[model samples]
Each structure stands twice: as structure tokens, then as C-alpha cells.
Target: MKKTITFAMLHFGVAFTITYLLTGSWVLGGAVALIEPAVNTVVFYFHEKAWKRAESKQLPLAA
Candidate 1:
């Protein structure tokens, strides 16, 4: 949960900052900020799944 929130905030800040710098529009910045979290969530879900698969494959088997 905490990881999710942190990742979302990080993505949101980056997206908002970039959008604001390029367009100088608060409305667009706000929209990008809103969209960032949803995008991060989707990305994180796949990332976590991939990590889990990798970890499981590396686990030692019982004798």
C-alpha cells in the first residue's frame, strides 16, 4: 500500500512538472497529475507480477 502510494506520487509529480513546464497550463498539469496515478498503478501491477515470477523461479527447491 505504501509502495503504491509512493510510486503514484512520484509519477504524478514528474508528469505534472513536465506538463507544466512544456505548456505552462495549470489545467493541463492537473489533468496529467490525475492521469499519472492511474498509469502508475497499471505499470506497477505488471512490474510486481514480473518480479514475483522471477523470484519464484529463483527459489531453492526442497530436497
Candidate 2:
């Protein structure tokens, strides 16, 4: 729980900083602040699924 919250804050801080830097509008920055995390969360879900599929296809190495 603590790790999740820490990463959430870290992600938000970095996303907000870059968005504000590029747009110079707090409204736009805030909108991105909300949207980027949601988009990434969905993308990460699919990415992990793909990684699992790839891992399943790999053969075991010799000892």
C-alpha cells in the first residue's frame, strides 16, 4: 500500500512538471495530470499481459 502510494505521487509529480513546462497553463497541466496516469495504467496492464505471453514461449535453459 505504501509503495503504491509512493509511486503514484512520484508519477504525478513528474507528469505534472513536464505538462506544466510544455503548456504553461495550470488547467491543461491538471487535465494531463489526471489523464496521463489513467492512460498509462491501461497501457501497463496490456504490457504486462504481453510480457507474460512472451515468457511462456521461452524454453528452459540447461543447468
Total backbone clashes of candidate 2, pairs 3 or more residues apart or in separate chains: 0
Model 2 agreement with the true structure over 1-63: per-residue lDDT tens digits = 455455556777778889999989898888887788757756666776889899999999999
Q: What's the count of clashing pairs in each model shown?
A: 0, 0
Error in Å for residue 5 of model 2: 6.8
Instruction: Candidate 2: list runs displaced more than 4 Å.
Output: 1-8, 60-63
Q: Rate the local accuracy (lDDT) of all candidates.
A: 0.86, 0.77
Off by over 4 Å in 1: 59-63
The predictions' CA RMSDs to the true structure, in order, are: 3.1, 3.0
**TM-score for candidate 2, residues paired by index:** 0.67
